[model samples]
Structures are given as structure tokens and as C-alpha cells.
Target chain A: MDTPHPGPDLHPHCTIVPPYLLVRLAKLDDPRFAQAAAAARESLLRDSQIRQLRGGEHPFTYSGARTLPARTPGESDRTISDAGGQERLPGRRVRAEGQPAGSDPAVNEAYDSLGATQALFWTQFGRDSIDGLGLPMDATVHYGKQYDNAFWDGERMVFGDGDGQVFNRFTISPSVIGHELTHGVTQFTANLQYEGQSGALNESISDVFGALVEQHTRGQSSAEASWLIGDGLFTDQVEGVALRSMKAPGTAYNDDVLGKDPQPGSMADYIETDDDNGGVHLNSGIPNRAFYLVADALGGNAWERPGRIWYNTLTGTGLGRESDFAAFAAATAATAAQLHGIGGAAHNAVLQAWVTVGVMTGRE
Target chain B: MKVIVSRSGGMAGIRLTWEVRVEEQPDPATWADFLNSLPWDDVTDSEAAPDRFAYRIRCAPHEVVLGETQVNGPWRDLVNRVRAANGM
Candidate 1:
């Protein structure tokens, strides 16, 4: 319900679903959802005013070519941070002394993701680190006790050791870290509100950049890359697949604990919800599938034309804090045309990707 | 009050907990009322001790079993407890 913006930006970001999801939840079968929705709406209204007052200040600063030296390795090897950026002590199972620094698979995964995300911005968009100022990267792996989620807490990224039944150590997956960090990147760039369809797009952008980072890191072509978030975070005990499959949105998980993966590959099947910051994770499947379509259509390395198109759009396009799927689609197409000539493969891929996702046809 | 809620049984395998102190001898009925009044359901059964009452709350995305006690009782109280005590 809190808009990412500070004030007067209540309708800060565009959402795939109407704000009516809160309205719907308010009328849900369960009294709790109704209460939760009512509370969320109140906060949303309050956040609207807050956003109005904090106009035009970037959450993350921009500083090209500035590099902050990494902190000297501290004796207290493990550190954790909360959603609001307050640091916490590490748990025993993930004690820094128990595992060698950067040697732990989780630590390595975090480092690699940070590197890849940083490089993508630097190489493709000329953007610095998460704050675009080369902010010393800070990531907390194994956050919370059996924390089942990973998130960017407006400052640093945090990973969770999944319950190991439905999910594995989030740090095992580079995309997960990249996805979280990209939220910081988004915070700096567009500051997209993490609610409704705009929030979904925000989530989708993280996924898109996440998959790109993985592909770039592995030197995998778009055709070769799995385009799966949390690919390595699923244990053998889990069901048929990884966290969220870009190639196949709804087929990620079907376990009893998490129910079915509620991702939709197309606009027609989009999920509308008020949970998880307006269902940012759930509705992301639509745009995730759209990116997959674009990457597949263009072929070769995704970080090539498709990546360029996206990176250009992300950095250059005047995407509003409230930009929606259609707005994003247009920007991508425009970026593709700008980079690879009008009606080029990149441009065509953008149109085709959106069309496959059942957005507007005949790019205007 | 300090309460520890450990969740070893569940599909998520996530163990999360937070402690709350009510500043008085915790009545089982009052504790039960607080638990029952929650907009959630408990996944595990619980019991009360001389110094504390414990409850296990199971929810996907977050799960924490908890114990509670009066603030100025025995025990130096942990840093987390101190934060909780100070209502941080």
C-alpha cells in the first residue's frame, strides 16, 4: 500500500490489474483478506500524499565510472539486513566461519550475480552499480530463520535459505540475487511502484534483467539459456521444475505447500491480486514470458539485440514510474528501432513479443 | 517476555519467530484470546510454562512459533528482547 514514491505519487506506477484487487480482497470470502485489503487501501491513499511531496529525487544516485573500493574483509564474516536496511546478526547454520568466504556456493552465487548485474549496466547502459554510483555491493545470504523469500530492501539484497522442500537456498541461484538487486537498479532508474500492473512490470523487469545477467554470465545464447529464475534454488526433492520458468510460466511448481505456480504467460490469463505488493511476483510471469518470446524470436545470445533493446529502453526511454505493459512494450520497440534501424530484427522481436503476450498488434 | 517459536514441521522448513511482552503475568485465557483474536490460524499445538507461553503460527511465506513473558521478570533479556522490550 505504501507507494515507492514519497508523496503525491499515489498512482505512482501502472499496474496490470486495476487497484480493484484491493477492492476485490475487501469483498473476499475470508474476513482477513477484506481487512487486509481495507488496511492496504488506507495506506495506499496515505502513500499517495507522501509521494506528492517527495518529487524528483532519485532513490539511487547516478555516477558513471565511479568505483567504491570493496570493504576490507571483516572478522565477523556474516552479516544480514532487513527490508528497511537495518543490519542483523547472522544465524548459526550460515555462520561465516563455518564456510569459507566467497567459497560457499551461496556466497559465490551472490558475488557472481552482483558482478553480472553490475557489468550489464556498465557495459550495456553505462549505468554504475545498484545506485549507479558504484555503491559497494552488500548482499546478505541466508537471511532470517528459514526465510523462504529473497528481496531488495531498498538498500541491499537479501537471500533466504528456502525451507528446502518447495525452495532451496536462494543464494544458489544467480538470477534470484540479480532479480533482487535489479529492484535496487529499478529504484534508481524508474523507481517503479511495486504494486498492481506497474509493480508486476517492475517485477518483470527484474526477471528480464535477471535472465539477461545469467545468460551473459554463462555466455549462453538466448536459445541456450533456461531463462528460469531460481533455477538452482530447487532441490531434487521438489517437483518437476525450478522457481519460475520463463519458457513456461504456470508450470514452475505444483506442490501442496505453494499451491500451483500462478504465473500466466499471456495477457488473457493474467492474475489479479493485492498480495505480494500487488502480486508483483505472480503477474511477472506475463512479462517474463514476453521477454522469453522476444529472446527466442531474435535468437543467438539474449544479451545481444534483445538485451540491447531492453537495456536501452531501461536507461533511455522516459518510462514513467507508472508505466504499464503497453507502455513498456512501446518503449522496447522504440529502443529496438533506435538501435538496430527501423523494422529490424530487434524491432520486430519487440512487436512479436508483445503480440505473443496478446498486447496490441501493429505497433503504433 | 521472551518466547521461542521453532517450526521443524512444515513443507517450507522456515523457522521464524518474534517475542512480545505484555508487562504482566500472562493469563492463559488472555494469551488464548490474543492467539484466537489473530487474523490467522495456528499450525501447531502449544503450552504455557511458569515464565512464558508459546504458540506456533504457520503461514506460507512466513511462519514463527512464539513464547512470551512479562517484561521486567528474570533473565537479563537478549538484545532482540531488549529491542522488543523497548518496543523498537
Candidate 2:
């Protein structure tokens, strides 16, 4: 026997409902329930492999089926779908951009995040669009069967729509949308190598802005805002509070299925790994904590000073192609100095944030 | 043996790594030309050594770090192993 190739295994970075949850589902007395759960898990694995193999056909690869105004149109904020709509291609669906509100709030959340991110970049960054032109925001809600992760390909953001067993709908929260869109922003700006600490910084920037976008929209201060990313993505079964907690890193969630929140609260426990774009998602806890510190230190609105500093560093500074955590600290400090002043509170905050994370700036 | 061309840095700012098999050890000229033929303008030499680089080109059982200058013996053997593994 060919040692049975172990079939296919999940990629290190792949997101799915915890296998433990599936085991529970598999143990259910109801035959239909157990069978459905098993089928869902199988489908998720298959879909993840399909996504990896497809490699390029990420959802939202196209603009919406129809076009919206170049700027904000007077259209009401609503969700639209192409259910029963004809398929233009194998996976492509043909539906008007403004058909009707999606029944699921998660779907609407994805759309809202997309729209808000686009608007934020246009209004604040003055970038043309996703590509610095008017590249339409494309998103695929309910991507994989019960998939628990959301990601942005080079083109559009694809949401798993969640299996409802572990996660409800990815669209239930705006931060998830913001998180994915900020990946696009990083793509266009730093184009940070998606490996090692550089990759972690790439992820951290996304989380920083992901939360900021929601806060800005709601006009909530850093203290007032939950400062949690993907707050609504996880279901009640999950033991943790949120997906990732910026204010209190590492406390996002802790459960049997997903295990403990792998994120670190400070730099002392910063993780280092060679998998998943060099453990981009893992080490991001460092920068995520840094942003939280800066926000809290400054107090009041996070978008005002802390957000400006980080945004400037990401877009303005020449971040290293393979930057480590230390390089990022230097850049943020420099960015704050350039934006605020040498001894300005913003600059000091950047320096202090790194210290809290166990990394000092400039031989300090 | 198969030679994998895993380019790490380029103008598109993309760290694209892909592998293609080659039969015999190709002529250095042709191989160099093929590497040069990629879209290079979008990338400038950030560190000024070269526009882009293949940090690690793994040939199945072996691997090599292609530096800026002379191809070392270990690097050559690494390529040979890949070719042999691919049964070229």
C-alpha cells in the first residue's frame, strides 16, 4: 500500500470550524444532524483545497454584476444578491448591484465594510480606488461551506459565510470587512512580503485599520469602541470574546475547538514560525498590541492621532521589503516624528508601544 | 532534473515562487536569458545587487541560495540533484 497519502490535510493557515466542534456534531444522536455535520466538514476541506488549487479565482474577482456611481451614489444602504440569477460563468453570478437587501446581516456587513473601506481610502488617503483607479469593490458572501475565515485575494474579498455551527455569518461584523479590505490597501501600498515579520506587519496594519474603519464610522472613541476585530464572526459556542482583541491582545478567544487565542499580549510572547506566510497571522499580535497601546495612550478618538501615525507609516514611509518587528518600530516612530513632532506625544507613544512589547527603539 | 525558479522580489512587489523542471543542465546563457526575460522593469534594485533574486530554489531533494556572484559548488550540485530527481 502507498502509505495512504493521508488524503489531503488542511494548510497551516486555513480557517475552518474547529474539528472538535465537528466531532460533537458527528456524535449527535440525530442521524441527519450527524450526517449533515460530517458532510459540512468534508465540504469545507474540499473547498479549502479547491481554493488553494484554484489559487487565482478568488470571489469578487469581478466588479459587481452592475456598476454603482463612481462616488457614493444616493442608493440606500442595502444588501443585494443574485439568487436564482443566471450564472454567467461557472462560479460567477449575474445580479444587479442594488437588487435587494440580503436576508443575512453577515452578507450586508461584508458589503458595508467593502463600501466603507473604499470610501475611507478615497476620502482620507486620496487614492484613486482599490487599484488607484475606480476598481469596483467585489466580494463573495457565503464563500465556502461553513468556512470560518475571511481573506482578500489580489482582487476581491471572499467571505466564508460561516457554517453557522461555529460561526454565524462573516458579514455580522464590519471589522471583518475592514480587515479584508485593508489587505488590499497593503497590497497597493507596502506590498509587504507575506512572510516572516514583514507579513506580520502586513496583517497588523489590516487589523489596525479594520478596527479603525468601524470606529470611525460609528464615531466611537478608542475608549468607547470595543477595539475588537471580527467581534461578530464567532458564534456563542466559542469560548473567547472576539476574534482578535486589539486593546487586550491574546484575550480574543479561548476554546477547546479553536484552542487558546494564539495572539500575544506583549512582545515577550511574540510567536515566530515559518508557516502561513511566515506566521503572519501569529506574530501580528505584536503590532496589534502596539496599536492598542498607542490608541489608549493618546486617549479619545483612535483615528485622530494614532490612526494617522500608523496610516502615514504604512503609506508614507519606506518600510523594508523583509522588515522584522524592530524595523517596523523604527518606521512608526519615524512616521510619528514626521507627522507630529520629535518630542510630540504621538512620537513618544510609538516608542512606548514598542517598549511595552519588549522591543526598544534605537538601541534603547 | 527539474530546476525550480522561485523568485522572491520583483517590480510588481510580488514574492512569486514557482517551479519548472528542466531536463539537463541548461546552458548558463539560456538560463540567464530566461531569468532576465521576466518582467523586471516594474522592480528596481532596492539593495542594488540585482533587480530581483531567488532566495531559495528548491529542487525537490536539494536546495540552493543563489547569491549575487559566482555559483558555488554546492549550488551546482543542488541543481544537478533536482535534474536527477526529475529523471532528466
Instruction: Work out candidate 2's RMSD over C-alphas.
Output: 20.1
Candidates' DockQ values? 0.03, 0.01
> What pairs collide in candidate 2?
A106-A171, A106-A172, A146-A163, A240-A253, B1-B82, B1-B83, B11-B42, B11-B43
Encode model 2's per-residue lDDT on A1-364: one tens digit a residue: 0111121112211112223333444455665454545554464455556546545222111111112234442222323332222211123443235654456664566666666776555554544345443456776665544544556656566565555756766667788778777777666555577667877787789889889889878889888999888786677887867777877777777777566767777767876553344456667878888889988998988876787677767664346456678878888899888877898888888899898887774355
TM-score of each: 0.64, 0.61
lDDT of 1 at A133: 40
For residues B1-88, write the lDDT of model 2, one tens digit per residue: 4457443321111233444445344665555444444332332322212112234565445554453222335444444444454553
Chain A TM-score for each of the predictions: 0.74, 0.73
Query: Model 2 chain A: which ten-residue window has the lowest total lDDT?
Result: A1-10
Docking band of candidate 1: incorrect
Top candidate (lDDT)? 2
